[model samples]
Target: MNSEPANRRIVRAPRGTTLTARSWQTEAPLRMLMNNLDPEVAERPEDLVVYGGRGRAARNWEAFDRIVATLTDMSDAETLLVQSGKPVGVLATHPDAPRVLIANSNLVGKWATQEVFDALERQGLMMFGQMTAGSWTYIGSQGIIGGTFETFVEAGRQHYGGDLSGRWLLTGGLGGMGGAQPLAGVMAGCSVLAVEMRPAAIARRIESGYLDREAADLDEALRLIDEAKASGTAISVGLLGNAAEVYEEILARGDLPDLVTDQTAAHDPLQGYVPAGWTIDEWESRRERDPAGVIAAAKVSMARQVRAMLAFKARGVPVFDYGNNIRQMARDAGVEEAFDFPGFIAAYVRPQFCRGRTQFRWIALSGEAEDIRVSSEALKGVVSDPTFTRWIEMASERIRFQGLPSRSYWMGLADRVAAGLALNRMVAEGVVSAPIVVTRDHISSGSVASPNRESEGMLDGSDPVADWPMLNAMSACSSGATWVSLHHGGGTGIGFSQHAGFACVADGSDAAAAKIARVLGNDSSVAVFRHADAGYPEAVETARAEGLRRPYAEALRG
Candidate 1:
């Protein structure tokens, strides 16, 4: 801690039409980068840690300041080039080119291990990007709430034959991405028991209206879970304990849950997961002083947790990996049966990906809730998806704004374009107070190529192909995205994944409208094409119906 950066201070995004940059195109990324580190959003902003352990917005405070300064004075015709969170160069380009182009955490295959990454990081050469964090699109924990809720609802349809009312979901971890699980479970009409090692995380979720109850002991947490299930009520209970320890204890008790999954940060064992029987302080200290020991201890603990998950799977529980790379960690620790269960993406989210639907979000730069409301209401006009409408309504009522007021639309490309255009028109007409930034999670259908997560099990067994995301970044750049980022080793950790991110501002200009239509359509078009190329029939059908011109696909159809 003594060696960390000295710039430990509060940071917030500028609100209400303040022009810190030359234009909204430049200002959008600046505001989002600041928002990512907001005390209300970032998991540990003091150390530059945003979400996943050390998934920073910039390499250091110096890099952060430089990035902000670059964006502030940048011309619309110049594009800033960032490498692993450092602003490397600003080159002359056309106005339609991406204002910022970033490449983070990209290591050659031979040197992509966590050990090498840790060494380079200690020398201040690189930083982990972790999906949305480095790309500056994170919307706090609730950013993932809608996706998690839909996953639970889909799980209900698959196993329990449609409602999850009296059922209970047993899962672990409540940090960052996992923090959404508890509330998502309740919103899906189920009771949930989530085990987390941090007391502060539990309290934070409760304060954010994402968790309903908190317990310091396992027995008390179980009591709460039981009472909710018995009354057929939907509620979420966050229990303070190490996931590995609590999981083994639960396995000993032999009471099965309706669903099972995990979100512990097992991907970066040295800094992510907490080892069983270790105090949080010990874990933190050992992470810096004895990284090898921390990794070894976390891996051993992860094996224990995986064995318990396997037991639940053998007992017919709807168990799966929630994409934290826990199974991979356990496999490295000699747990061969660890991967008998499927990943959540392979089992649940792939069909949606095939249809070009994922997590799309828009943030009101004014930080006004009414601005978000006006935009979300515009979405209801484009499509009558009851699920979409219900989520929007519930989120409006229940979710609290973190840093910037935002709304998520889990919809297809056409609806996304229509909604975005409507918002742009509203901005022009003064229906909304300021510019809105439209973006999507890096885990979208066409954006990521992580075999352990997004592309877990492709139809053509092309899970390891990295071309899709590379093509995605190029497509977004060609389509005039405000910022286009290509990242390596984000979602599942070093050496395991690659992804892309794109976000553009809707500033109510003709240029902004052109970029939104092209980029948004390009986003879904590339997704359908990728899945169709992978031999998914749903993807093929969607491609044909959407009039996407793939010569081979059209030839095959004829």
Candidate 2:
């Protein structure tokens, strides 16, 4: 082994005396071996070390033995090493030292058992493991998985501080699109100031019990906002109406902290409605031919609406545009008729009922057919007579100028009447082997006589006659070898409107019957059935037997 200089010889200290150079030198080799064997040993440059002279080998041997004995008597030592770099090697050495080392390890393998982790916890040691490469990877992987630094930075900012709760306001509570805005705002936890013009309409809304008790007009709404501001609540406002005066009034009040308007298409009446002749295919073709022109046209239209909305925005209000499917909206609004003929035909020929294919055939009387027709023609003669007027007038004062009825009431009534007439005509024409004529109690003029006795039936009883126009039209089709599938109408006891009827011809020969069956065969919101001839009770029974279904049962009950 190595030898030390005589001048550097270590002197032994007395028993229980503080450690001296000679004592440390004599005990150096044994202490070094013990430190090496001890897993808790520090690095060579940092930890204490000793050297011995050649003459002191015997003393060194004795000192080494004494040192080992002293160490055995002492308790295990604990040390805490805190460093910026990895202290894994230091930690591995002191496996049992109740020690802690803080560092980042990208791949933290299962190094410590449950017992060791518990021991570390007991010793109040916190080991923090953070990602080293600034990239996340599964074990045994090296490549990045679409890391975004900007997103990470933004996420960090949000986590530290981000305000989410802000006051919101919604305007307009009268027109279709505008009316729904306030309701939507209330659901989203925003304060709403519904500004409706018509007092009667507002009163109607109040009567309907849709609004809150505190809901009020513009003046009252402004008063509430003033009161809220006095109470120190931030108020944000949203406008939904097209009225420029109301928009200007809101701007002039100047109490709103934040204002937003849903004036998506305020400038033009045809803003969101597609022009009559444009189809999706044609639009796409035009888009390809002159993309810039198409864009400019769209921008011009949109810019006008935006400029109108910007009147409020210029007064420091924010605006929101709730856009919709323009083409679909136009079609629903009946503006599609203004389009080209092909487009108009496409819209008309589109399936009305989802499940069926029924072509509404328009028939006009010729010269001889018209000459033979009479205004007071009998119901049977009308069905058989081709001279009957093809165009039937179904008038409704309630129809809007927009060329659309308020609801489906008239259309549904017409369809039901047509079905009955077709069936009766088929039976008269011998197109069907069997024609079942079903009539409900409310529509039939016959007495409440049972079908069991034909002579007991009185043709001119209390019930109103069937809708003749629809019958006449169907009958014309039936006379041309088209079998009617079913016919139904009401009996004496009930009113005409309450009564329903249908006729069923044998299946094979009638194309109209096939179409009706195809249309009616699927699951639908509405169902038609053969009417009962006997009475109301019989009609109910017939309806039940036919398995007739209606989606809006509650609405129909009235």
The candidate maximizing TM-score is: 1
All-Cα superposition RMSD per candidate:
2.0, 41.0
For each candidate, what TM-score against the reference? 0.98, 0.22
Instruction: For candidate 2, write residues 442-558 as lDDT tens digits.
Output: 111111111211112212342233333134223322332111111111110101112112222222235434433432231111212112221234333434554555334325776
Cand. 1 TM to true fold: 0.98
Which lDDT value does model 2 have at 347?
20
In angstroms, the error of model 1 at 144 is 0.9
Query: How far out, in Å, is residue 43 in model 2?
Result: 88
Cα displacement (angstroms), candidate 1, residue 377, comes to 1.8
Off by over 4 Å in 2: 1-166, 207-210, 213-217, 226-242, 263-308, 324-558
Clashing pairs in 1: none
Q: Which candidate should be chosen as best, given lDDT against the real structure?
A: 1
Query: Over the full model, what C-alpha lDDT does candidate 2 score relative to the true structure?
Result: 0.27
